[model samples]
Target: MPKKGTRIVCFSPKSSSKSNSVTKFSAPSRFGLSPKRPSFSQSVMDRTLELAKPVITKWNPETTTFAKVTSLFHESRGEAKDFIKCVHNLQKAMHLLVTENPTSDNLAVAQNLMQISMRRLQKEFYQILSMNRAHLDPESVSTRSSRTSIQSNSTSDYDDDDEDVDEVRVAGDSIVQVEDESSLAMADLKLIAECMISSGYAKECLKIYKIIRKSIIDEGIFRLGMEKFGSFSSHKNKKKNMDWEVLDMRTKNWLDAVKVAVKTLFNGERILCDHVFAVSESIRESCFTDISKEGALILFGFPEYVVRNSSKKVPPEKVFRMLDMYTAIANYWPEIESIFSFESSLPVKSQAITSLTKISEYVRTALAEFETAIQKDNSKSIVAGGGIHHLTIDSMNYLSLLADYSNILSPILADSPGDLPESSESPAPAISRRFAQLILSLLAKLDGEAKLYRDVSISYLFLANNHQYVVVKVCTSNLKYLLGDDWLSKQEFKVTQFAANYERLAWSHVIESLPENPAAILSPENARECFKRFNASFEQAHRKQSACVVPDCKLRDDIIKVNLLRKVLPVYREFYNKYRAKMGNERSIVRFTPEDVGRYLSDLLFGNVGSRSSSSSNQSSPHSRAPQSKTSF
Candidate 1:
């Protein structure tokens, strides 16, 4: 048999037989929605029909009984096609109808049929979606190439010389010849994303996105001017009039660029993030007249489109491709705005206040979603398709967003409502304990620096100031929507899962055993205790993981290495501070970046706080405080 949970029921009337027909055939729409209409080309229909024989044989060995009793259903693909062709044959006189032989009602009827057909096609698509097959996997885009059709009538393919005023191109002859010719193929990828949304092909959309954004890092285009919004349009009109390196890109190369961009950012590619941030800044400067510098920080590397530059006489669609590219790069993330950076554009004083405001907004959103998820138990609705089979992506994304938004709560509480900290004043909060206390709940399960959501995770530092927040839950009620049932339960250990469950055991065995609330004075002891627990957990998970026997010895070693956190003292301290920092704010928890893990650990194990930080000595939060013996976590 296939994997236990791998099988999905084939609803072909023949396989269902008489006893099962009422549930499978007569009851067509499970959600009260109309049956899905087939598409114009309807490429999957014949294929689905071909698949029916195998599926029926596998699921209903009693199909012979149906044949013997009655041939009531059109069980063959040819019969189904004949029925459809006959239904459309009446449209052959459409030209006569156009000549005033038909009433407006006739047009309306035709439109309804079209709509119904479309809807049925969509339904068929979703039926297949129930399987969550590899054809729509999130990491691979070419799984269904045979069925994925493209319009060949599109404009030029490889004209490298046409870098016109509106276009952009890279200086490469192989990808395309002219920078001016917009790639029909590249546009197809973007369109594919849009189509996926309509077709409920979200997983495929994500795959297309991965192909274009972060899968390949060397492609400078992915790292090109993203962090900035307006910079894309700011290219001197002379340059706009000049050829855009943007055009000469082949579909594969364009996807290569995008995949590289997102992959590196997710993989903690700090340098690439820096590059995206710079471009994001340029894009903003070109667009937002009243743009705040703080916005640059938060919005950097967020996936979005370049808006129309009215003053520049640019059409909005012209920026569509850029946005498409950016979207393709950053589509996996549901919430893509930069609330913190939006406000922190000015001095430390005002920036702090502004950051608090954004943090509040972010928290509000997250709180709402988290509450809804809890109340409705909507995991099933969140992840409905079989393609990713685990719609756990949203729940994990929402969880990480919760952690990030909760991160800044402490800082917000630490600052006085009326006054901002002075340049000469200590950067540490006046009431670190309260701040830590408030954030502890939010940071309870935080294991590592990054806010990963299990198999799918991303770490970015372009605008290191951003915080995440959730929008709404997957469903209003679990019964109403078929969101994943296991969303909330399984994601409790998001950070640890990303860390291969090492920190989970570490924290539970050690950190959670400590006081719930710790005073500043006792924080040092708590930190040590937490560190000890972390080490223990790491060792335990490490040993068990190492014991696994694989044909390749390196496989086990790699598994340990990939999941292991090299214990460095300062990393513990920063990790501790990050935990502490979340206590007061309880809303704005920053996800850990590799830099936070790498740099801080170096300082803890060795005294040197790398020169990479401009204010190495002035590290803002005092994470070293540790939990007091009497305090509760």
Candidate 2:
């Protein structure tokens, strides 16, 4: 301290380490003998470090201490700006101290404090977003008078920040009376976004970024650094001086945020909500820009918009939503084409078709998974089975509508993997033929599933029920248009075949006692023996088959009373009446008259077997040949 111009400065150690440390410096000696004179750079560094000390020393990152940050945002007049000011000062001080003393232990403490400050700011931003989600309608924000109206209301009710604080709006959409306001707004957003990024809250940063970009677009500001619409300054009309660089940076952030949102939306575990729709719509809107116009469908909004990571597990819901979104886009092809037509672009249709192929792959994958589960343990499957059944019906209806409305399905069905013919003159039959093939494949899988049951009667009954449902749906619904008249008749024929199979499996023994030519069997001993066998067989079939489960009540009645009984009872009556008198002394052996047979048959299958008079004169059964099985003889 020999020189008169010397200055004494005290430097403190890191907050977590020794706190009170001193550093001394003196100017160059006048005698010109001292070599360690502090340089101009050293003096400036010393001043900045000293200025940062108090902030570092008093840094308290506890949530309770920072709780006021969020409170100030919600409760203060300046919104995020008020909160940003306090935390930003500390952050700036920390940065200066760290930059000056890079290797010092105190620098680490400063960095830690900076991180805490950033996280606190990010936490507050999220709170604001969550609180204001419902109020974030674009139309409301776009209206010029909305903010002033909000301000008027908020001013009367609260002492703190107005309720409508930080309501995001585009620059030109509303005229703010105050000058340099948009620039200030952008500065605050950039600082807050930096804090968000440092805090590991990429998602929060994206929300702010989206707002900024939307503002840029709404304000009619040039975002891509090009002037196709006009010079950036021309739109300003020299009314308000604006910083184009800030807009440029915000545009970059917006693009980056879109990439992040795409990856997030592809996650299956998360529900597809309004947030997802909003992000998707924004990205889709951005596609028409010169920067993305060329490969917009491929690069931003289609099947290969983002490169898929195959190793990660994608949820089915995510794929389903992607399909739904692509379908929506495809439906809007004409409109999108009209806009992009100036560029000579026809990518929407081709890209949309690619997306449909991807959707088909997902459908195939789901079906495979379902089939595998069924194969593993068919009895344990309830929800999956029922879901697939419903999916089949719904998918058919959906595909039919797609075909009828747009010619979209025609290409898909025509190019659908392998089974369909090469070309067809009629679109309806082509789609029908392909869909029928798919349904047949599903039915075959279901048939195999039914056979897994240990009870043969139940197995056949299950097949009957499913087959009947499908046939009925095809006959009555729009499916008839696609499947054609011949397809409907075939399905009906299949239904009849299933009915015969169910009867053959459940009641063949009952019908076997009737002779091929019952009139030829006239001997008393033979007729008595045949009558006894008929009664025993009928009783056995009735007891076993009655307990079988048919979940659909209407189907149960149709198969049993209307279809099977009508085909069996009249034949039973002819055999019984012819044999009743032939059993002379063994008349007591004739347990049931034709009337009793009819009543018992109806009562076993359904609850009511009609009146005795109604039963005695039976309606003729359909002349169906007995199914070819050993039990049918």
TM-score of each model, in listed order: 0.17, 0.41
RMSD of 2: 21.3
**Residue lDDT tens for model 2, 557-580:** 666677666666677667777866
Model 1 C-alpha lDDT per residue in residues 393-486, reported as the tens digit of each score = 3443434332332233333334322121233233343333322222232232221222332222122110010111111222222211221233
Off by over 4 Å in 2: 1-320, 341-414, 420-434, 450-461, 476-479, 514-527, 549-568, 571-596, 603-633
Runs in model 1 lying further than 4 Å from the true structure: 1-92, 104-115, 128-133, 143-633
What is the C-alpha local distance difference test score of each model?
0.30, 0.45
Superposed Cα deviation of residue 97, candidate 2 (Å): 64
Which pairs clash in the backbone of model 2? 75-161, 76-161
Q: Give the root-mean-square deviation of each candidate in angstroms.
A: 34.4, 21.3
At residue 36, candidate 2 shows an lDDT of 62
